[model samples]
Target chain A: MNNQLLPERTVYLVSDGTGITVETFSNAVLSQFDQVRFKEIHLPFICSIEKAKEAVIKINNTANETGYPPIIFSTLVNIDIMNLLKTANCIFIDLFGTFINHIEQAIGHKSNNSIGRSHMVSDSEKYRNRIDAINFSLSHDDGQFVNQLNKADVILIGVSRCGKTPTSLYLAMQYAIKAANFPLTPDDFERNTLPATIVPFKSKLFGLSILPERLSEVRNERRPNSKYATLEQCRYEVSESEKMMRREGISWLSTTTKSIEEISTTVLQEIGLSRTLA
Target chain B: MNNQLLPERTVYLVSDGTGITVETFSNAVLSQFDQVRFKEIHLPFICSIEKAKEAVIKINNTANETGYPPIIFSTLVNIDIMNLLKTANCIFIDLFGTFINHIEQAIGHKSNNSIGRSHMVSDSEKYRNRIDAINFSLSHDDGQFVNQLNKADVILIGVSRCGKTPTSLYLAMQYAIKAANFPLTPDDFERNTLPATIVPFKSKLFGLSILPERLSEVRNERRPNSKYATLEQCRYEVSESEKMMRREGISWLSTTTKSIEEISTTVLQEIGLSRTLA
Candidate 1:
C-alpha cells in the first residue's frame, strides 16, 4: 500500500435525492479499487441547470482546497449543467449521459434526444410476467391486506411461509417498494402452471422457490396438525408446482437458502431494477 | 452465441432466509457448469438440527425425482445440516462452511462457531463500520422529534426535498420502521462536522446529498418565493454542505440521477443490514 507518500484521490457521487443507486454501484465498483482514495457525496434535488453549474463550481473549488483533484460522478437531470462544469479540472461522469449512450448502442438506434437507464432492460420479458402475476395475485389474494399491489414497485413469490410477508414489509418500509408476494400453493400445483392471467405479462415474473421441508416447518408453526404442515403435502405441492413450471418452460429461482440482502439483490437484478437506499 | 440446447444445470443457494444472494452469485458462476439440469431451492430457518435433517431427505428425494444427483449451493445456519446432507449424492457448495474454513485456516485458529452469511459479514470490522454509518445516518438529526429516532429501523438522509418524507412514510406504513428525517441545517455546515453524538456510531452514518437545483425546484413548489427556493441558495448550500462533509471526514453519496430503487439498494448495502425477510 502506498499510504505513506501518495495523495488521496477521491470520487464524488453527486445526486438529486437519496443518492441510493449511484452511491451503491459506485461503492461496489470502488470497493474493487481499494487502493485509491475514492470518496462519495450525495447532493440531492439538483433539478435545475443553475444549481448544477454551481455544484460543478463548488466541486472545482473544493478540489483545490482539499489538495486533491477529485473526480465528479454526477447524476443530474439538467444536461446544460453538465456543460457548465466543462472547465472543472476533474473527471465528470454523467450517469445520465452514459445511460443515453448505452441505450442508443443496445438498441442499435440513435435517437435525436437522450435516453435513461429504464431503457437498459426494456427488453426483459420475464419481468413483465412477474408484474402481471403480482397484480393478479394481489387482486385474487387481497395481498395480505396490502391493498392493490397493482402499484407494487416490487413483488415476492416463494413457497408457503418462506418469509414473503416480512420481506415484503421490509422492502416497503426500507425502500418504499410497493412490495407484494404470493405463495406457491397446491392450487398452483393442480394447475401445474402460473395463473393464466400471468401469461400476458411473463416478462415481469420473478420466482422464489424455497425448500419444501422449510415450508412444512413454517406452516407447521401456524397449523401444526393440518395437511399444510405435513412434509408429504409440502413435497407433493412443491414437486407438482415445479413439474408444471418445467412443462410450461417458465424460468424461476429458488429461495430455499439465502439471506435477505441476497434475495433483495436478486429481485432487483432480475427485474433490472434498483431499490432506494437510506 | 452458442445456445447449445440450453445446458442442463441445477443451481442451488441455501441460506437462512430469502436466498437472493445465492441466486445472484450462482448465476454469476453459471459459466462453470455448462452441462446439467438446473434446479435450486432456497431453504429458510435452518436453525435446528431436526429441521436440517428433514431438509436433507427432501434434497435426496428431489434428486431421485429429477433422475439426476443435484448440484447443491447452500448457506445453512448449522454445521450439522451439512453433515446430514453429506451422504446425499450431490455436489455441495456450502457458503458458510467454505468461508468459515477459510477464516479458520487463515488465522490458524477456529472461528467462534458463527454461522450464516449475515453473521459472516458481521464478523468483519469494515462491514460493521459501513453498516454502522448507514444506521446512524438513518437516525441522526431528527429535529424536534428528539428520541423519536430511537425507534427507527431505518432513516432517510438527503437535501431539503429529496423524497425523504415520502420514503419514510412508505417504510413506516409498509414495513413498520419508525422512519424520521431532518433537513441539513446551516448550523451543521458552520460546524463542518457531524454531531458529536454521531461519533460513537459513525458506522451507521449515511448521507444523502441531492442536486442543488432539484432541491431549489422542490422548495420552490412549496414556498415559491423564499430564499430557500432560490437557485443561488441551493447552489451555495449544496456546495457548503459538501465541503463540510469533506472537512469532517464524512463519506457521503449523491441522490441525483437515480430512481428510488437504486437509492434503496445503495442505502441497504451501505448499512450492511437487512430486516427479517420473513
Candidate 2:
C-alpha cells in the first residue's frame, strides 16, 4: 500500500532528557505498523510540572484538532510530572514508570527517579573516552594519518562512497569505538593487495561494498556528469574492491540498502567487539 | 549509596535488530537505580527460532550462575521466537509486545510485525540526506570549506577543544542537521571579533564554551605542557570567545559538563530547528 493512503496518527515522544531514548523506542515500535503514517512530535526536556502541563495542553490540543487522541510514549521520571502527563487525552505509554517498579521489586531497592541521568556525563572517564574516540576517528578518516592506524579498534575499507565515513563516525560516536576508514582507490585495486599499513591489523579490518547503481547515484550528487561518477567506473570499483576483500579473506558486506546503524552493528559483530551501548 | 557496595545484577538486551532501541530504553530505566550495578550483555540480530533458543539458554545459564534471575529486555517481533525466549528463567520484559497490542487497539489495525525494519534504509531520500549532512559537517569542520557556510543549518563557534567537533558530528549524524563548526582560535580572539567569513551568517551561529580547567585537561591530552594547554591560556581563550559571542548577539551555552547529545539538542532547540530524530 502507498504510505500516503494509509491511516494517519499523531505520536509524541516525551522525555526529560534529550528525548533520544524515548524517540528510539517509539520509532522501533511504530515501524511495525507499516500501514499507518505517523506524524511524530518530540517533547524533550520536560522535567518540571510546568513543562509536563504544557505538554499535556499541547497533546490535548492536537487531539482536539485531529478529532482523535494522540499517542504519547513518555520516559518522564518525575512522579508528579508523569502523573500530570498521563492525564492528557492520549493513549499514554509509560516507558520508564512501567519498568522501574518491576525492576525495583526484583532488585530490592527503590529507584532514585532523578531526571536526565541516562545521557549525562555522569562517568567522566567514559565520556572522555568517547570524545577521544571521536577525535581519533576524525583525525584518521580517509586513510590520513595511517601511521596511527594501530590505534583503531576497527578499520573500515571500501571503494569511494561505499558507506565508510558515516559508518566509522557512527561506530565512534555511539559505541566509543576508535574507527578508521580507508578508501579503496583504483591504485589499490591494481595492486591487488591490502595496504601495507593495514597488513598487520588483519583482524581489525572490516570491508563494505556497495551496488554500482547506488554508488553512482551517491557519487553523481557530488560530481554530476563527470567520468568519475559514471556507472561503469562505479561498477568496476565495487567489483574490484569486493574481489580484493574476498581474496584477502576479509569479512565484508554490501551496504547498498543498509542504514548507518545496521552497517556499524554488522562491522562490530564481524570484528568481534561487543561494546556496551553508550 | 555507594554504587560498588550495592548488589550486582545481570541484564540482557535482546533484539532482532541492532538492539539500540532496547539498549537505550533499558539504560534510561536502569540509570534510575543508581544503587544497583549492572553487567549488560547485548544479543542483537536474533531473528530465527534457533537464535532465540540460544539466547534462552544463555539467560538461563547466567541466572543459574548468579543465583538470581537475570533481567531480559527484548524487542523480538516474531511471536514464536518471543515465546521461546520467554521460557528462560528471567524477568522477561517484552518492550515491543507490551506496547504493540495497545497501539493496535488504538489504531484498529494489526501491525506488520516484521523484524529489522526499524533501522533499515527503507526511505532512500531521508537516508541520503543524513549522509549528505555527515559529509557537509566533515568538509566544513573546524573552519574548513567556509566558502559554503551559507548552506549550513547551524554553525557552532567555540574555542579549541570546547566540544564543538563531536557536537557538530552528532547533530549531523543523528538529526541530519548540516552543522558546521569553527574554532574560536587565538587569532579570532586577538582580533576581538567574529571571523570575517561568519559575519554574514551571524544568525546561524551558536557558541559553546568550556570550563578552563576542563579545557586544559582536554588540550593537555593532545599537546601536553604546551602553552596552549595551560589552564591560564584556556581561561583567556574561553573568556574572549564568550565576550565575542555576547557582543555578536549569538546564542551560546557552556559545554563544560554536558554530553554530546545534550549539546546537540540544545543547539537545535536554540536554533529553532525541530528535526525528527533519525
| Tens-place lDDT digits, model 1, residues A1-278 | 66455435656666544343344334333332333454455554454677677777777877788776566656554456557765676666654454444333432344343222221223334333332333333233324544444555555655666656544544543333556665666676666666654554455556666688877866775687897789998888777766765666555566555534556656765666543222
Q: How high is the TM-score of chain B in model 1?
A: 0.44
Interface alpha-carbon RMSD, every candidate:
12.5, 1.2
TM for candidate 2 is 0.95
Per-residue CA lDDT of candidate 1, range B1-278, in tens? Answer: 35456534444455554443344344323322333334446564466777677777877887787665666766554567667766776667654454444323322344444343342233343433433333333334354354545545554544566555544433333223445555566676677665554444444445667788877866786689999799998888788867766665555677665444445445555665442111
Please tell me how candidate 2 rates in CAPRI terms. medium
Off by over 4 Å in 2: A1-7, B1-6
Extract clashing residue pairs from model 2.
none
lDDT (10s digit) by residue, model 2, range B211-270: 999999989988999999999999999889889988888999999999998998788878
Backbone clash total for model 1 is: 97
